[model samples]
Target: MSLPVPPGPQYADKQFYINRGYHQIPKLRLSMDRIVKETVGLRPFRPSGPRIEAEQLGSKTIVHNYGHGGSGWSLSWGTGNMARNLVMATPERKIALLGCGTVGIATARLLQESGCEVTIYTKDVPPNVTSNLATGTWSPASRVCDPAVAKPEFRGVWEDATRYSFRRFQFLLGLNDIACWTDEYSVRNEVPTASEHSAGGEVYEIPGLIPERVRLGKKEHPFAADFVTRRSNLMFNIPSYLHYHLQDFLAFGGKVKIHEIKKLEDIDALPEKVVVNCMGLGAKPIFNDDELIPVSGQLSCLIPQSDIQYKLSTEGANFIARKDGIYLGSNGIVGNWDTTPSKEQTEKVVGILQEVMKNMRG
Candidate 1:
């Protein structure tokens, strides 16, 4: 057997490469890389399950369902289910919904299903709205909190949220802009493979798993290690999706009123006695709710790069996505709340991307 040639030092931590006469030759790198994995856990709801109890808030008339953090979209369907139960006991014909984001839309739809005329009173509509600003990935696990700590009375709330959103999206699986269920591959640092005893199949040693892009692969394709790709979905086009949702709402005889509430007295002015709040990131001043705080996040959109359909992230402060454009940014950067990319940061990301592209280009 031929001995593996001893190679010279090059990039520290990188394996050395040697050629006919060249020593420490740089190895071929790939433009594609893995981005850091995010545990998309929803924000934990505070101790105030019902700041206004059911009986106190006019249970026979009012239903409060709001304060969902980032997972608002993901948990909307389920949260709506619980809220619908409130009206189930009552025979109310009209209901008022605060906020017109994903949560509001879903709750309004659920209310309409119960033969109730739903009015969405919000300062903004869809498309030109905050819901449209989301990346629209289909991970419905977060946005609320760890449901265990919720009041025992709210035990069924969390489960209802997960099940409702899951089944709802399943029903709208192939809808137009609502959800662009495409192939997304999430590559990451090497990790231990799952054991067959737990996996119920042959344990494949996957050094790199294609995490996001959901695409059917060509037959007989080879991989570096045991890799698994699933149906990764994202809200590729938020504007279009919001339009579709708005149309659905209007079609169902739901009305949207644009009005901003400055104080608790504003909510008191609503004609409908029953109110379901679906305001996202708006609980700060609307109800004088001090628990809601803004944990700011920023992203950058670059020129489109179709060749890079996949997303990449290192650990933190580094994320690269190829969508309508090559989107890249870091949430971990300090003193950088500005959404507009700084020239220095832009150049730095561009350089990192350029190196990745050079190494991976076939």
Candidate 2:
């Protein structure tokens, strides 16, 4: 019922930031590093929060845990635990996990940790699933659910899942080259507000939706922008993180079978007693979930630059430097359903990222 207090603004000192020498990194451009790859991934988004309940069919229990939308990786660990507990309750020691993307793999491991034997049935494994192509920021609410239609109680579910996953990801911060890392963000003007800022959910009232934001003096910030807001954001380098999860799952006696189930009848054929549906977008056709939409997203990867440890967010796109490479992206199209990369969009993103990098160097 009370007004929210905003962070106090600090004046940007031109001389203070300029003298810091944070801008020492050489200019990075799209042309400088060859484009190693360009990838497109359709986020399995259900405007509603992920399907985390169960269905009973002829003595079989199928717990639906997919449809996380774009927040699959960000919310994986928490949802994994959610589905794991559901299966644990059924006294079913053998579990079948559908889909092997971030959500599926995470859920598979969680079931294993719960003393259940998990057999993953999927069309593709890590670094191959659509999850591998994500520009995976630990942004728990990025299209996780359409807050407009979400019930008031959904906020509680989101808060618990986000906070739980946040803690779980922290445990991976410095291990295995730590696929999870933070990067400095250079703002062109005022910091952009997240999309979920005004969805009328109680989660909006929670603090730390993003890491603490600090105003960078003109010289202190590494970028060329006159006004900059620096913040540390949790980023998951998809390729490396996927590998880590796969290896971890395999090390723990989990089994994976390369197969895709097209309909409900296919459930009867799996080796496990209970199933956790992490099929993501596949749930739409398989389970007839008309609410699920494939939000098409694309990212272009260039050569890696170890010196670059920052990200830049402009009006329509973002540029990030990851362990694998610098990523340039994207123009989102909802309901488009096309996964093919757009040459025009790709060129425009390159311009946006290259212009920012050039300005920073200047």
Candidate 3:
């Protein structure tokens, strides 16, 4: 029951075990007693797609770079480069970068490498930022933009960012767990319908950019499902990844100032005439972007297991094994701003995985 190796870069690498048959399935202990913590993150979603263009605000030229939705981490390097190019066109050598989250840090690092002085002004840092709460998967198109409202030209921007980011992430592998590849399994009772596949909404795909999903025979895997498909993709260990980037930025002479920007006037007061906005969801009130909304996502983590190396996705739940814990989450609720952890939601998510592990054939 060995599966046919999918034709892709990952398959070409024998280390991925693309053509290998299954061994004994490792028993996964998933129970409420193992629950460690619950956290929430608000994705900065813009129905019109991410705003990466520049705008004029009084005496300052603000290069807008926020509103990335769930793709902040996946597309960070790409969008960061785009934002850097925008700033390079200006004559200002000293720049003020807003926000200290994933996007902001990436943008600041790029700006620094381009020979520009960067100073970050933010209300919070890692572990307190929204990016820290992310599940850390490479989801470049997750709720990026609404199909009905996005312009025709936006597709090209999305594709370009996705491709550029994918290439950049490859260089960071094997560096203190900043980023690495992980096998993801999608298990289901029946073949997924087209609509079910598109349940996440309009997706902009880049063909051949990642390994193709290969269906595994019943004996090839141990998941309790009628069908199982596997694909290898990159994921970030959010804590260490962010810490590495922040440390790099500081070591490279980048400056950080803890300040809150409440209005346009606050931005105008900055000494740097050129500014890059990586404020994520905070851009809504300060920049007066009505289209920006908060998409709430919650995760419940369990005690980490050394053998749980692969990610899993069922109909309504997802599991990612990070160094911190085994994270469990479901499709988040749109337009929800409450960041409070939900006990009931945690129970539901953990219960689903508990049932799946309990039914494992191995």
Checking candidate 3 for backbone clashes, the offending pairs are none
lDDT of 3 by residue, 224-338 (tens): 7877788888899999999999999999999999999998889988999999999999999998899999989889888999988888888778798888888898556899999
Candidate 1 lDDT by residue in tens digits, 193-280:
3321111111122222223222212111111212322234444455565677778889988998898877777877889877777766
Cα error of candidate 3 at position 265, Å: 0.8
Ranking by TM-score: 3, 2, 1
RMSD score of candidate 3 (Å): 3.7
Evaluation by TM-score, superior candidate among 2 and 3: 3
Runs in model 2 lying further than 4 Å from the true structure: 1-26, 194-205, 222-226
Kindly give the number of clashing pairs for every candidate: 22, 4, 0
TM-score of each: 0.66, 0.89, 0.93
Model 2 local distance difference test score: 0.74
The global C-alpha lDDT for each of the candidates, from Candidate 1 onward, is 0.51, 0.74, 0.85
Off by over 4 Å in 3: 1-22, 193-202
Best by TM-score: 3
Point out the higher-scoring one by lDDT: 1 or 2.
2
Q: What is the C-alpha RMSD of each candidate to the true structure, in Å?
A: 10.5, 4.1, 3.7
Query: Which ranges in model 1 have alpha carbons more than 4 Å from their true place?
Result: 1-55, 58-62, 142-156, 190-231, 234-236, 303-313, 317-326, 329-355
lDDT winner between candidates 2 and 3: 3
